[model samples]
Target: MFHVAALGELLIDFTPVGLSNAKNPIFEQNPGGAPANVLALVSKLGKKTAFLGMVGQDQFGLFLKEVLEKNNINVSGLKISEKFQTTLAFVHLDKSGDRTFSFYRNLGADMMLNASDVNYEVIKEAKIFHFGSVSMTEEPVRAASIKAAMFATENGSIISFDPNYRPLLWSSVEEAKKIIGIGVKLADILKVSEEELELITGKIDVAVGADMLFREGVKVVLVTLGKRGCYYKYTGGEGYVDGYAVNAIDTTGAGDAFLGAFLYQICDMKMDELCGLNKNDFKRIIDFSNAAGALATTRTGAIPALPSIDEIHNIRLTR
Candidate 1:
């Protein structure tokens, strides 16, 4: 059985390279899409993962499928659509390694994934069902994603969600919040950026925002704090862990890496063991994940930046 089954977009991220002699900027194509990136890290850590999403029948789509297979994730659940071309995002990274995107997706193939295209068998077979908010921005894909999540839950799979919010993807903040809130309610475990927490809850304090999620039936809420590490909260417990020191080159998939590492620990444990975890047990997981996130930022690209399990352990050993 697959350890995780993820359903979402598979798009290209065009990152800035440099300006030419003529003063025109160049870009390098990198494969990215939040759910794909997360599963890449999980698969990198030796977990069996499968991807479920539609991609255009184009060269870029073919390349993304190859990249996922190369990353050790199963591609059997991937679908190809003839109606829309592959989606593209022009990524701009500021001095702090923060990124913004300009998406070219007027009817992207990812947005065309209908409920009929969903892999119900894959969701039923997986131990964890993962998804992101990006696919919820449109129809058909939104219906497919929600259907998969429901099937996974019915089959006893843990639902994992990441609100990897890119403001540019949505038409309005209020609508975005409403849709993303639907994802929050469906998840057992959630990963959100500090900004995403505020966006979803309209609260500045992490604890208060996390509490809002807890009331939504979310069991564990993890708030990513970038370089400061992460803040985590669960029933009767909560704490912050500092990330390891690293000269980050890019922060693209760092959060994904952190989340994957944390979920890896969950996949390793029995449901009973997970239920028995206390505050101290959570601290160990957070520390390990923080190191993994730090290591990912020290490199470039999402899949390429993912560190090995041994590498993450070594970081903890050396520290």
Candidate 2:
């Protein structure tokens, strides 16, 4: 069975590299999109993964397909759109490597995916099915994402969700909350940044926010606290795992790295085994994930920045 199968956008991220001779920023094209970033890290850890989404029949789209194939992820369900171009996000980073985005997707190819285009076979065969809110920002793809999640759940696949919310993609905060809430309800494992936890639960306290998710029927809640660490609440227990210290150059895909590493460790476990994990068990797992996220930030791009298993271990040893 596939370790993980994800349904979402597969797009390009134009991350600034350096300043041009004219003092303008020079950007580099990086393979991105949250779900794809997660799969890349999982594949790095020797997991079998698949990507299901739409990309334009263009240069960037073709390049993304090649990147996934090279990373050893199954791309058989990745569709090429003739009507729209691939989505693009220009990432602007501050001194601390925190990022903001400017998107070029009014009607991007990823948002064109219809429910009929979903690969039920991929979802059915996956041990864990992952998705994010970016794909839920618009039509067709929104329906496609929901359909895949429901199908995966019905087929006994563990559903993982990350509300990698990008404000530019949403028409209104209320709309985002509504759809993202649906994702939260479907997830057996839900990963969110601290800010996202507040966005979804309307509570500032991490524990309280997690409590709200638990009440919503979510089995696991992972709240990522950049630089500080991660807080997790499972069915039987909860705890916080401190983050590793690293010279972060870009925090673009750090969260994806964290979730991917976390998933990689638990992908093979049964539902009962997952639910039975206590605080100590989660601390060991989240610490490893924290190292992966920290290591990803030491570099610039998303997929290109994912650390090898050795690198992750070395980072953990520093603690």
Candidate 3:
């Protein structure tokens, strides 16, 4: 059985590398897409993991598949679609090294995933199944996303959701909330930014927002507060973990790294052990994840920024 499996988009993020002589932005292609980044870290941590997604039958798509395979993640469920080109996102960064995405994905390959294209055989054996809201924004792909989540549930795999909201991908805030609510209900665990909490739950406070999700059936709610760290609320527990200090160069995939590390820790424990785990147990997990997230920012790109288990462990030890 696999430790984790994720079903979602796989694409290339063209991030600003530097300025050209003429002051135009110089972009570098990085293999990205949230769920893919999570699985990359999971595989790096020595877990048996697989990725299920669609990509264009082109060079970019081939590059992504190769990257995942090189990370030691199973790609049996990955498909190459001839109908659409691979999705692309041009990332713009602020002075703080934070990013914004302008996508080139109208009817893109990642959005063309049909429910039939999903390989349930791989998902059923996973200990955890992870996804995000980006895949649910469009049709056909939306159905595929829901089907995979349900299939994972029916097969007894844990459901993990990250609402990696990108405003450029949605038509309106109302539509995003309406669709994301469906995923919130399906997930056992959720990860969202403070802005996403307000957007998704209409609650400004982190605890209030988490409480809103709990009422909707989420077992655990993780609010990622960037440099302030992460806030978590579960059935009988709630607390905040302080984020690690780092000289962040690029913050592209930090949240995904945090999530991958958190899930890896969860899967490392027996289910009953996790259930019986206390606030301290949860704290250790979140602390390790916070360090992983912080270290990810010290590097550039998504997959490239992912930290190894030892790297995270050493940081936690020294800090």
Candidate 3 lDDT, 214-289, residue by residue in tens? 8888887889999899999875588899998888888999999999999988986654466467888788888998
Q: Count the backbone clashes (under 3 Å) in each candidate.
A: 0, 0, 0
Best by TM-score: 2
Better of 1 and 2 by TM-score: 2
| For model 2, the run of ten residues with the poorest summed lDDT | 274-283
Query: Candidate 1 versus the native: TM-score?
Result: 0.96
> What TM-score does structure 3 among the candidates reach?
0.97
lDDT of each: 0.88, 0.93, 0.90
TM-score of each: 0.96, 0.99, 0.97
lDDT by residue (1-319, candidate 1, tens digit) is 9998899999998877789899998888899898898899889888899999988899999999999989989988899887789999887778877777899999999999999988788887799889998999989898888888988889989899998887878889998899998899899999999899999999999989998888878988999998898998887588798889888878888888898888887986655466568888888999999989989888767777889988999999976
Error of 1 at 262 (Å): 1.2
Per-residue lDDT tens digits for candidate 2, residues 52-90, read: 999999999999999999999999889998889999999
What's the lDDT of the predicted structure labeled candidate 2?
0.93
Model 1 C-alpha RMSD vs. true structure (Å) is 1.3
